[model samples]
Target: MPRPVRRFHPLLFVSACAVVLAACASERTLTPEQYEQRLPALEARAEANPSNAAALRDLGEAYAQTGAYRQAENVLQRAEAAAPDDPKTLYYLGVSKEGLEQPDAALTVFARYRDLPPRSRFQQLMAGRHGWLLRALLRDELAALVAAEDSLTAEGVTEAIAVFPLTYQGQDSLYRPLGRGLSEMLTVDLASVEGLRVVERLRLQTLLDELALTQNAAFDAETVPRLGRLLRSGRVVGGVLDVQNEQLRTDVALWDWPSEPLPGLSSRQAGLAELFALEKEIVFDLLVQLGIELAPAEREALARVPTRDLQAFLAYSRGLLEEDAGRFVEAAAFYSQAVRLDPGFAEAAQKNQEAQAMAEVAGGVDMALAAPRRSARPPGGTSLVHNRLTLLNQNLGAHVVPGDEAREPTADVPLDPLGAEPIPDPPPPPAGGN
Candidate 1:
């Protein structure tokens, strides 16, 4: 047995591994303009090495980016044949399918991309991009559905609605949870705004549960109308999900509950984080459609609350939110706390000052009368003049005769003795001589 043993060629094994890796790592980096300029070079490369899958894939991507879908398909198909199981070739083919508006076919390619090893940097990038595109497409479909719903004026219109995962082959359950989480987060964020209403997933799930409905189950159009009426929501959001290049892509859509013919909004994208962000944006637009007013305070709160190191700012936002909610006392407390945390936090300091002033004014008649009215009048208008005089008399009487109250002194709080002298009138306007 020892004498019959054979030796393997190390160099040959290394070469084979390198070729496989190259095929697996195949990606095109040419920008649209660069791709256009290098088309001739790519063509020459392909002509010189007809079996070079990488070159063919790159050329196909270049063609797809330039709107040459048919040519891209042809080139990508050849690449696929050349490297039957190569993820890179599969991804390029998917891109070509997308360019051709064949999303179903493209999804299959993206699915294969998702199954690649996570350590591949090329796969990572493609996965993220593919997920993003898929989510965007789903969002577009949703928007069309919403639009269809808006187009309907009838009191009773029915439509069927189903949402499911769209992964390559049958890997459906893997990314579905992310899709559901994203939908719920979006609904919650949007619903938190005043004058906006979003249908929460729990309610939807409950309804489905009551009916023993699964994602594959189809409800009648008339049933949708009834569901819409019960939910008090005219639109429904749904989507498909897939994995590409070890990344997840989701396509979400908003559609009319009973008339799902048109989409209200649709978007496809890669990565759960990006999909969540897009969902926020879509919800924001929906709020706008529902006539929700995002106040300046709300906007500022949102901008500041998400920052980890901005504790003072977060406290300030809490204060403002409380104030807007008519919890002035709580607002003052928050603002004061904020100022204590960061003495130089000017906005918080100012808010604290205003809240204190307001509190004093609310409790004391003198403070209430002393505070300036917010109006478009000149600084020392009639009311201000009267108030100033009243304050002067009260102070003077307090000093001269305790407990002897007097009407506020008119327009003349005594100035500092060294203050500039008042300028004399110009001879009484020259006695109106003009």
Candidate 2:
């Protein structure tokens, strides 16, 4: 019998395991009652194996499901220490933080979630969560800053610049959207300059809208200083765009806001087709006027254009307008058009994802509910082969099969996977594809 021992078939083993898992996943469902039933067993496993991250994560999630956030937080912290960079653990930890009303801590956790390379739908959901939380925090901070506008000084925000939407002085409504598009381009380019901190376009717009400064009046040189003071910006950039006969003329001014000094103004003219080149010239000129010396890499980055296709830029600009107005659905549509027109426009692609995710978040899609849970490996002392089989079998909803010790499956699996809720179809592309 020893001489006739047969060879182990690796491929057959893999195929058999795959078939079993496929068959079992079809039967797994963790209803509320099942999760409740598994709580005691999950607790026992964690208690017996204090250092097992998997066991702790399962117990913490079960506790979170039962609304015991404090206990969940305690175990999740242990799980995070044991399994650093585990998205599942970090996400559940963030939920516990939110339930504990720790917005700052939750933001930090979600920021880590956001920085992780985009790999799954759960990561995408975290990106949206991070953005939504940031905006909410910014709004609260802005209210306090505005109330103390008089106390703001040049002591801080010295290197900050705020770019407002360019004033449009043209009869052709078709080109009006460029006001926002040009301002956004300037903001992005100027941010490349070292030693300068550009206020985000969205944040600047939010503040302007909050102060009612955007309602009836255009942002002129006189208004720049006032806005800079309110925004705690040391420098403010505002400009006018005059277009006639397919020719473009730009008048840009930089106000040294805190000191109430005379602003430096510059003008440039170019054919509409040469908009990108003209914008580069304006950015360089502003840098020179501000006494900023650009490093070679910074100069190179500034020279890079976002898009060569005018139509794509137009679509992207329209998306910005829609997004700023809280019309995320329309914004997503326009952004999608931009991507379709110019597939290489990275900014457009990122904005499109953000718009879609934001739309989902706004529609009351709970992040915790949307993310699927994975089974964790059991604690030490078991054979590696048996441990893996146990975890895989539990994940696939299989019953314990002739195992060393009888154990129940972790009840963390989502009953309905995120795939059940597809990102809503972007509304049909604009009529005539424009």
Candidate 3:
């Protein structure tokens, strides 16, 4: 369905300011336009360079200004799909939807826009749009909370839990990349503990794709039960990430299927720079809540950090998220960073090579990123952001090898598994290599 047209201001057309959009493009000079004859040229520009996200955005804006709200919504969405998470793209999407009177959908995009970090170059615009939209939806916010509370039930259930991708619910979008990255890292770390049947990342992606749930569903409360039931999980373990002062805090909850509550909630806090240890703490607490007895080997693994090099881990986590989002070219950049940061990081190196190859293929990708840029690094940092207002952080654990289709937990942790046995590290690939 398309959003309806609410109003059209003819004088505000593309001729006024062509807004030849690009990332961080506030200074990009726009072509002067008269609202009277600007639409065709903007459309031609977008058609000529289908991969030019800035041009697409400008075209969408032109449509909105002309009162073609439905067309504006469709075009703006395409811009968003290509640019993924660009605040300008999202802002236009929100504006188009707002013009069509779909405040609910508009608010979602506005939230994503506002949640972006300080350096996104659109912070001022995001803040203004976010404030107005938030005020517009104030009444709906309370209604949503009340509805969610009323839907809750305390029905007892099995111990199985599926940790959905962790999300950044804070006020800035800088940490958004860590949302899925943390989930994947948790899955890897939790896999170290015996008896827990962590859902593989691929299978969850498959399910989400099949169900046609948008990425937003991972952050939606209403989707938790359906997601758990589909995966046959007793609870879905995922939660909000927030940074306050120098502290990074995560609140994990197990949303039992059928809207029940379980004894599966825990929180972990650490200095923004000390997130590697926090990952292990979350795993331990999850195991304890699930009644799993960890063997000594498992205990040891939990105590150990996945990697001592923080920069490599950060690069890997950024790659992890880009990969999950199907932005292979973007992912390749981060993976390349990881490999460069730690030349010994074989898994990252391999993934980087693969992503670079895949991205360059004639797949349905925009030409901008399709051409491999091995030296590029996605938007993120090797060091922790010290801003008292925000931060983005994630640590890499073991690289996951592919597994069989995910299934329910059929058994408990047995004694003397990897946890009980002293797992020996392989001798550094036989000096020169294996």
Candidate 4:
């Protein structure tokens, strides 16, 4: 044996070591039942080593798996303190917040997680979480506003207005996209007014989706005041769009909750080819109806159109519809088309990136119901978003534990894992207990 040891090969030793590591790696993936079995030991380990972030994180994850969100949140918070920049700890903490129905807190934590360095591993996941929570918050706010309307008065932010999607009276689906596009244009132009506040188009869209407003379904007269209160706007604008013989006509009605008499309607008509000019005229007329004396500078800002190309605007409008419907993949495609049709269309470009980011993070997973990633560029190359997704998909088992990695999926593991399972809401914790 001593003589044979004289020719021991380092390459052979390396190969043997690799085989052992492979076996260990395979054993790390445990079934839900197996994870449950290890809870007692994990808890004991964490309790014995209060400062051990790894042990605390593991115990917290086990609690989360069992739907003990309060316990998980407490433990994960401690783990976060022990390891301040640990992405996995923060991720679990965010999930626990979600389970507790504290979407705002979850959003803050997820934002922190998304902003962490080396984002290539979990960027998509965090982006998806952002979109998901934002939409949920919008729905919740609308519900809360409606419930609290009895105590709410006509009093609201005096200069603020929410421009809702136009009710398209036109028969052609080809012109239906204008409902979203025209309102968005109005919102943009009106925002230039010095003293006036414009409610974001996203807020209006989400609320409309919540209201289940159909293409031709007009805004309910009864709900108008409530919508203004929810949007924190004293004034609300709803419009109707009609097209006939290549002539475009838009009529906007103003609802002022505070005033005894409602503002008069404003109407504009122009050729389809002069859509931008028509939109500008509508903006000026809206200002006049609101009794807002626009300064020269404000008029200049309002005159700037988003895009001159009608096709690009149409594509952008289609993207808006898809986005409002939560069909992020389709939205991204339409946005991209808009961007291509007119490269200077900044809004379309921005929307395209946002839609793509959301789609990437959602990855067609049931964790969130956005569409999957179909990269315009090949994912195998140096694309940052693609790389992030690739790393998450390919390196799930071997990633660093309890610090830089994501929460390991255990309970009813997803077919295409995004590395974390949904933690259902748990019962409230006992009084005076963590």
**Steric overlap count per candidate:** 54, 0, 7, 0
177 Cα displacement, candidate 3 (Å): 1.4
lDDT of each: 0.46, 0.65, 0.53, 0.63
Please write out the lDDT profile of model 4 over residues 1-434, one tens digit for every residue: 01110112335434433553453244323344655777776776776678978778777877765667899899999998988766656766777787787879988987874465533323445555677677778878887766776787766446588888898888766777888899888887777677778899888777766767664453556666666766777778887888877789988887776564544567788888788899888778778877878677766777888898877788789779888888665566567666766788888877766665575444212232211122212223333232332333233221111111111111122212222222222333335543
How far in Å is the alpha carbon of 29 misplaced in model 4? 11
Write out the backbone clash pairs for model 3: 15-33, 15-34, 115-172, 115-173, 116-173, 297-419, 298-419
Question: 1 or 4: which has the higher lDDT?
Answer: 4
Name the TM-score of candidate 4.
0.66
CA lDDT for candidate 3 = 0.53
Which ranges of candidate 4 are over 4 A from the true structure? 1-89, 113-121, 148-151, 155-158, 213-223, 229-232, 260-264, 291-298, 360-434
Best of the candidates, lDDT: 2
Which candidate model has the greater TM-score, 2 or 3?
Answer: 2
Off by over 4 Å in 3: 1-160, 209-221, 262-265, 344-347, 360-434
Worst 10 residues of 2 by lDDT: 397-406
lDDT of 4 at 300: 79
- Comparison by lDDT, 1 against 3, better one: 3
TM-score-sorted candidate list, best first? 2, 4, 3, 1
Residue 298 Cα positional deviation in candidate 4, in Å, after optimal superposition: 4.3
* Model 2 global lDDT (CA atoms, 0 to 1): 0.65
Kindly list the per-residue Cα lDDT of model 1 for residues 1-434, writing each as its tens digit: 11111222335434433453353244223345755776766666666666877667667756765667789889989987887655445655666676677876766676665576542322422453354444445445544544465454545433322222122222644333344334444555655666545664445544544445554442334444544654455665555556554355555555566445645335455443344355456555655644566888885543332212233444555555454333433445556555555566555555554443333223221222122121012334432222222322233211111110111212243211111111111112123232
Worst 10 residues of 3 by lDDT: 383-392
Question: Taking the tens digit of each residue's C-alpha lDDT, what string does model 2 give over 343-371?
Answer: 78888877866765554344221334323
lDDT per residue as tens, model 3, 28-51: 222223432577766766676667
Q: What is the C-alpha RMSD of each candidate to the true structure, in Å?
A: 34.1, 18.8, 21.9, 16.1
